[model samples]
Target: MKSIVILIFFLSSIIGLGQDYIFLESKNGFREIKLGTSVENYPEFNRKDNSNAELFKLSLNSKADYVYVGSNDDKIKTAKILFIYLTTNNNVISEIKVVTEKVLNVYAILNSAYGEPSSKHGDKWIWKTNNIECSIEGDQNTIPGYHIVYKDISNERIELKKMKLESTKKAQAEL
Candidate 1:
């Protein structure tokens, strides 16, 4: 009886460890796709029309720095992209935009894991544009979500809020 009870408890514990997030990656890094039921029908980048839309679907293990949206042209011109951070509901959230030529696809960089050393240690995500370089520390809040902080080369900081799953779903549906 004792062994049976212990085995049951262990099994229960393992089952309780349900997936909380999802990551979408393809060699280069993370991609910007939408998770959930609604957006799962669409392809990575539907070439039906002249749309440059791509969705970064999140599951129970998705994280990244940016979401790339490339063009279908050989040069990959006319790209529209954005940066994304994981949200509490396992969604990618960001406000950064990208407009480039010769675009192929976009990916995300798993900055750090929750409660990990990199997340708790020093700056997690760092970016530089033009002539500026910046670093951001992800130790400000204790929330279990992705926090996107943008720092220019000059050391200035910009904090982007968390991305929610419901909102992400809606956005993906529109796309």
Candidate 2:
């Protein structure tokens, strides 16, 4: 029993060390693209059709059609919204939201990387550190969701938008 516990602890620690590139942390950006990256770097693809300076989308060379980017920091710390969405201000990511069908895979990976979650509310699970707050929502019958929210946060407008989105979802669910 002690050996099994030790093994689990050892494996978990190894996974924890790689959190910098995990789904939540990478919400800042993906692959070569990262928060604070210059828009000019992606010269190969044109700016999305319905994008502006603050909130925009970028077409990437991947299975996903486009990645959403939102900046409340004057395009400084721009947040890249993939399966995990982020909001930023003054060039730092402040929050993240991830929704996907791969609940078990995501949960196992996050648990290994960040340890146990900090709280739980219904189908949602939350993990908070000094620097960030992350949450996962959904259940077996619905889509799985995840989020990484920053603390002493920045970008009120983005927060409002997030709230509106959640409200819409809740209203829909009720009906």
Candidate 3:
């Protein structure tokens, strides 16, 4: 009984350590984006026409990189719809989000690539590693859209977000 208890505690600690972030196991990102790649180092992919092109184009204002690849009949022409890279510590690509129309197809691909998910709720499935959290979710509407997100653990990002939240609250309080 004591041996079993020790084993259980050891396993739990390992699991806890794996869940430290949302994108820890993300080795690939939208064709060539790749996780853990520095923004300045990633190559520029060919952009194509797509329904979400405009939306991704607009998102470029805030993100380090936003590229759109066209789609036809809900199938991405380039196998990817959009590639978004968020700037974090040292201007590296800390977060990546890919949008697609084939939710199940992408989910299957991710499952095979990342193994079993840690948790799943409805349309969203989450996989965690020591430094990354990977998530896939889709909408329920007539024209459902799927999103694959990879987030890395970055202290700079957390601090920046905290500062933004504080500023927003301070402004609201003054108003």
TM-score of each: 0.18, 0.39, 0.54
RMSD of each: 20.4, 14.7, 8.5
Q: List the candidate 2 regions with Cα displacement exceeding 4 Å.
A: 1-84, 90-92, 140-175
Candidate number achieving the greatest lDDT relative to the actual structure: 3
User: Which lDDT tens digits does candidate 1 get at residues 1-175?
Assistant: 9999999998775544322111111111122323222222324432222242223333311433233344444121233323332221222222222222222221132223211112233534443332222233323344223333321212123222223556678899999
Better of 1 and 2 by TM-score: 2
Q: Pairing residues by index, what is the TM-score of model 3?
A: 0.54
Model 2 lowest lDDT segment of ten: 57-66
Tell me the whole-model lDDT of each prediction, alpha carbons only: 0.31, 0.46, 0.60
Each model's number of backbone clashes? 30, 3, 10
Return the clash pairs for model 3, or none: 21-132, 21-133, 22-132, 22-133, 22-134, 23-132, 23-133, 24-131, 24-132, 49-70
Model 3: residues with Cα > 4 Å off, grouped in runs = 1-32, 45-53, 57-65, 68-90, 142-144, 154-175
* 1-175: candidate 3 lDDT, tens digit per residue: 9999999998987766453232344454545656667666654533223643455443322453444344453343434564443444565666776666564567777776667788998868988665567888765564235767777755546788899999999999999
Question: Local error of candidate 3 at 153, Å?
Answer: 2.4
lDDT of 2 by residue, 59-138 (tens): 11122222343333312122223343434344343333333443356556556666777678887666654334565555
